[model samples]
Target: MSATPAGSAGAGDGVYRTGYFETRLAADPNRAVVWRHICDYLRRWIPADSDVLELGAGWCDFANAVAARSVTAMDLDATVLKAAHAGVTAIVGDCTDLSRFGDGSFDCVLASNLLEHLERADAERLLHEARRVLRPGGRLLLIQPNFRLNPKEYFDDYTHVAIYTDRSLTDLLTSLGWHVEHTFARFLPLTMKSRGSRLSFLVPWYLRSPIKPLAGQMLVVASNPAR
Candidate 1:
């Protein structure tokens, strides 16, 4: 994540900038569930020392967590980037045309709750761009809402335009020349493990706890074969 001139191209005109929870969920337990899922997804694949690129990174909460190397957080809204977490090198750009980067530019790519927002064709394009920028054998970790878990739960988010399943995502990656490594059916439960990790360090009793399963989010980790 090196610094470069921040360009405003394709940072669409506010379509992707809406405050998600503020407009819809109103800060409830479900929103908390969503956050937990996001954090869990981050904790699962993102080690503290990896160079990460977060696509469609809305406010950079997860981007802020990368401890391995710096995070290049990109979104289409400069205003959203402005409000992003402090350490992120926020870039206002689109993932569809990641021409600014050369091949294998990042160790990992993190995309949370973003794929369904695009039409099916655009989603495929996004995955192709992701493959192009990732290093050989590097990973792409995605956390997407499962359409099976009540369409309104995911569709309620204004940007959602497509639905997803782990199998469908796996097929998509295969079509783009990537290999699937693992898939988790739930998001909130994984989050609990991550939160448990933090707490175990605080009160050792939590270290012995078992994770609870709440199947609402799908986490997919895929790899581009080493070149």
Candidate 2:
């Protein structure tokens, strides 16, 4: 990712700077390959005809790929609001404060590589907002970097604030009254398009195989508290 400018918008506001996604992925070609399979894998777990909302959706990669009846890509950067993928509606909003959306309005909410960007309080607020926007039994799918797996380099991103692991993430959601539906302690390799050239070919196999040793990230799927 490119360096954030000194006076750039959102520098201290805690939102990711505009053009961050493009700059980060420009150097990697395999990210495109990996995301194709990753999207497919994630889509299998998402029910068809469901309305989906993606929090902190950068460039709408997964949002554009998921097989939902409707897709809304919410990001802190307004840059996404104009040029989103076809069929995906883009909006500028903070994940921690989604009062603009009514309660029980969506069937699924997605966040990838997002939780670590917020402070503890903000992350908790985001969790609550996600739950509130979801219908009863609706799902929340998260893919976040695991501090346990990438402790040495987790801080490489200057914007990251909250670190998490499988256990901590599961506990956080459960404590907030959500049901932990599924947990993959090691799901994907760190960095969308870096560290390995074989990743493009290996991702599909890894998702199918039981072992994922190089995975620097984890997947957590949860459901709203059943009334």
RMSD of each: 6.6, 3.6
Q: What lDDT score belongs to each candidate, Candidate 1 first? A: 0.64, 0.78
TM-score, per-candidate, Cα-based: 0.75, 0.87
Clashes found in each candidate (C-alpha, N, C closer than 3 A)? 4, 0
lDDT of 2 by residue, 116-179 (tens): 8777777888899889999998999999999999899888777676789999999999999999
Off by over 4 Å in 1: 1-12, 18-44, 189-214
Q: Over 4 Å off in model 2, which ranges?
A: 1-8, 11-15, 22-30, 195-198
Total backbone collisions, model 2: 0
Indicate which candidate wins on TM-score: 2
